[model samples]
Target chain A: MISFQHNRREFLKSSIGLAGLTLPTFLKARAESVGSRIPHKAKSCIIVYTWGGMSHYESFDPKPEAPADIRGPFGNIPTKTPGIRFCEYLPKLAHHSEQLAIVRSVHHKHGGHQQGMYINLTGKDPVGGIKAKSRKNWPSITSMISRFHNPTVGTPAAIRMPYSMYDNGTMMAGEGAGWLGSKYDPILLRTPAGKPYAGVNRYNDRELKLERNIEKRRVTDRLGLLDQLDNSLSHTINGSTPYERLDHYGQMAADMLLGSPVRRAYELEQEDPRIREMYGDHIGGQTLLLSRRLVEAGVPVVQALCSASDLAGGSGDNWDTHRDHFPKMKNRLLPVFDKSVSALLTDLEMRGMLEETLVVFLTDFGRTPKVNNNGGRDHHPGVYSLAFAGGGIQGGLTYGSSDRKGVEPGSEACSPADIHATVYNAMGIDHHTELYDQQGRPFQICDGEPLPII
Target chain B: MVGTFNVMEKLYYIFAIVLINSVHPLQAEPEALRDIERLNGIALKLPEGGWEVGFQLRGQKLNDEDMEAVVRLGSIVSLNLRDTQITSAGLAHLKKLSMLRRLHLERTKVDDAGIGHLTNLQKLEYLNLYGTKVSDEALEHLGQLHRLRKLYLWQTLVTQKGVNKLKNINPKLDISLGIDLTTIVVTNQKSEAKKKTEDLPQLEWLPEEGAKRPPDRSYTGSFIMVYFENNRSKPVKLYWINYNGEQTYYANIDAGQRREQTSYSRAVWLVTDLQEKRLGYFVTDQNTSRAKIPLE
Candidate 1:
């Protein structure tokens, strides 16, 4: 178990003064409050969900030993780590490999989009069949963080970026606060570019749309306003009412939109010309810069979505690339992503947030071992790759290995639950602790080992 | 050469309209068909009870399926859909406006469908389709609006299109689009940052122990934008207490939406002259994402 004193020392050093006076005071006040464990090392955890299946071939798990058909057509590049290799396009991230570990073998039983996505995201089978969605209402990794670690600091405990959209109006389910209850729900903030015209709008003024595109949220006043509304509108503060939850969420949203000093970080225009240039002129680099800013602001969690621009395409830039996969990965996707992620690792280590800030890159699932008729690999949940760096995770180590054809986990087939369990364990949560389900039934947070990552 | 021919044809029509004392003798003027001097494009709305007044699909969701865009006749009025997902490419065919007034393409994605054809709006007034992609070049064609009074130029590149001199000629015209960045997000006092360090006190607004606080604090602020890093960046949630030690802030909620409905709420905060301190900001998974001011 992690010690409180050592945790506090590391927290002060890693967080770069995030909690300011708040955390130190709370750590001291713990003597009188709950006799609870002071989550010391990094008081937060950030799980990056690279939504659509990201391709390991062009990213982390490049198989240089394989033929052009299997390895696709990208050059293997060296990293700061002695022998670890990345796609040539990922030269930016190559320099920071020392801070990361590429988990080469994570397999699962689900392969369909809905099922694979469900299992990897919720850490369990959908409960119902493919026809029926995951109605089990399992808590997302972020939801658990919000519930178990409501640190007395930061503006939001959990965050998703850009925004998740679905076909028609159906939003991507399983990314929200499932059985964890409403109070622990994450404040879902969508970024919409505004159009200014009229002098009037319920949103305030028309001219004010100038400030419509920044990322910061005003947090303090929002809370105070909610408190005022709560008192004037209701009798007693119910611990678990939709009213309180909505008010709480609304206040969090309003605060983020209005208060947090995060807007500058989100705007790529604010970064130094040289620094921005290093990351390349793209969305991924801008996101990396913003992520760094958030960790600095004392936010406990930050989830940056890593997308393949388009998920369809060669050697497998997006894992599901069916046709025209080769050129797309060779030209557009891999090179851009590589530079940005590389720049991120270097920036984090330079800033020192790498110690407390755990950066994880996880795709929906891996690719098929057998190439399809269209020259693309379909979904292969049997074996995939994930990467974790910083936040106490050991580096330059391959935790598991896949079979020769990359057909399955040859050495150790780690399930999604095991990965989630390892994440919670790294952050000091007892991996086997049973969290309550919606019905008050206890369910283990993760049913796997920590992969001996340390 | 065709444009030249059209210009010559328009001059001939002008001569005939001026020389002949005919009521509806000439269906339309050539210059009205094109050119900035005789144009009035802003109020592209139609007159009531004049023509068939064909249907318009405003505020409806659009898609990639081929759209049948047509307007036979009728004075279209009040396209006051300030915020819709319509694009300039979609609104390309609405150029034949014989009787349109109060065009409110304020938030539609209208572009230079016809920077030259815009001069066709003879009776145009009160034009706002401000947030469209119509650039300052569109302004050159807009010079024909002698009767145009209110022009919505927010979020557009009109100023660069030589509207500075145009505004001088039409001083009565109200031209604006967004926050006019000259006002906010800028520091007049080049020394403002320094001033805050020296003048702005450390507002210990955190209430004293057991001290009774005021009814509450009423605050107003603006959220310029929100960026979700999808995965790595943290969410925004804050908690606070008053001077009397009363909990004043709430905890986490995603996008901070209302539980039952879709909310489009923006917030503003209040700050006194006292030295106020901010605890850490609640971030989600990523390292950091910044929040900006001046609302772009």
Candidate 2:
């Protein structure tokens, strides 16, 4: 049987991690949504965010009958699922199709990179065509989950691997704890240690290391000094923004930094050699492995940026294939994605983590139907594909589809909000539950109705 | 009674004038009309920007010289030169068409040299080199076209390796690399790559340099970016040989400073100091926008 059994303390730790600080506030508001108290179907979630828009036509929704120009290059290949076809490049994913559910009709309105990313990551539209990211933007789905299920132990509630989504010199929106306090922000494992790309960020300077000459007595003295300083500040502050609350966050950060389990979770080198080989040495593969380790170590959420970092300078090769699309997908992009995703699914299933772990695959949006003059596709917000598996999600099924030319949604059109709702349902969080912002303004976590299939 | 009659007559004339003006709005010729007849190309001004130059019918009339003269007008959105008498020399004229979205060079003498001229056409979306002398080398020139969608290499000299190389640049690009169903080619199952210190050295981090950069921010040009990634522990002064073969002082890059800039294609980076003492040099190629100088 797929085990959903973890220690009760682990469960409580994840659900109400801010025991000494924010627990009272949660308890008072908990009665509004009794569903928040229910047992979660999934213990963890690994969201593989494929930034820069992976093409639907080339990956999940291959229309071979369409014109050569519309269909592009690759032909369709049979998956393990009956009557379902994927791109020829995704050979490994095709074999493991039985363990996956491909949703092919997730559509939205934002076409720009920042706008689409905002909607996809947060399930909320930008206040306007908000270009630069700000603190006013809606909190990411991971942040909302972190707020609901705060990790109790030294482990953080959520983490993001390698680096955050960046285009040119500007950082994209919706990859942070907007509206939510900075404490709920996902811990970013920027890069690994000496290896830089393979090992977890825990193997680097992120893990707390005392200076060579500084002894434990000096550290204790400094803490005492900090406490005295806090007492002095407390006299002046009259509001609830007290020194104790700041100390709570500081204490949590210190605990996380000094934690051994968190560091061990990021140590990919300690994993079995065969298992490491299963997930390729590529950045995406290693990051997914790290995500699995994190979830196993009691992290509720791990958002991974599935991309090849080597392509940053080479005409921006992170899935934004506006030209030479087929060559890139066939040779570099698709092969890495197919191998890594397949390995993750297989590894999770073998380890019996799939049943209690929701694996969500997402992208910015779909590409245009008509190929452009540069032999590539432009941004199209009409329709795209995303996927969810494990965590009570049925496998070997395609939820919805695009039109004949793979342009717009044909039937069962879904939005990013609906996908968010489905994910919350899988996690056993009430989709209709209301959460307050920094100013105490009430807002629904997800606006769209949850899919009946989940 | 005479005044009212005169006023009524004036109103009728005014109404007639308004009706005439609405029906017959004046039309101006397109911006390229002055030279369109000489080039035998149709020019239609877009409502937004640039001109759509169509040479579908009389493409054979335009030669290399005519192509040069016509492209000088600039702001061309689309250029259809199918079955034209133009050669590789004519492609140099298309370098200024930064707004070009569609280009058809089918059945022309355009080859790899001609395609090289189109590397700067960043907005070019549709490129048809069908029935031309284009080979594997033509794909090299197309690496910078991040917006390309439909490429027609049908009946050309492109191989599977060449097409795969181009696909690595932009995975979404739909190129016609003619995979015949009749031939069942078996690919070799190679062993996994041997474990190395670093498989992809281009992506490795260099020693951090402490050199400060001026905040002028006006230096902008389309060139291969050369990154002075000092993999060693020491500081190095960087120099580059320009097109004129003169070695000029670039910068004194500190060990902790990781500096990168768009530079010349065949630019040779000579690592030296203020005393003209030579350390080493890294020669950059056209294929990649980056070149790391890992001084030992």
| Candidate 2 wrongly placed segments (more than 4 Å) | A1-40, A129-133, A191-251, A308-314, B1-296
Candidate 1: which docking quality band? Answer: incorrect
Off by over 4 Å in 1: A1-40, A129-136, A151-154, A165-170, A189-254, A263-268, A308-319, B1-296
Question: How close to the true structure is residue A182 of candidate 1, measured as C-alpha lDDT?
Answer: 57
- Per residue, candidate 2 scores C-alpha lDDT tens digits across A191-217 of 242123311112222212222222455
Instruction: Give per-residue lDDT, candidate 1, residue A232.
Output: 40
iRMS values for every prediction: 34.2, 31.6
Top model number, TM-score = 2
Residue-by-residue lDDT tens digits, candidate 1, B204-273? 2223222533334222111112221112132333332232333333323233221110001121111111
- lDDT, candidate 1, at A28: 22
How well does each candidate reproduce the native contacts, as fnat? 0.00, 0.00
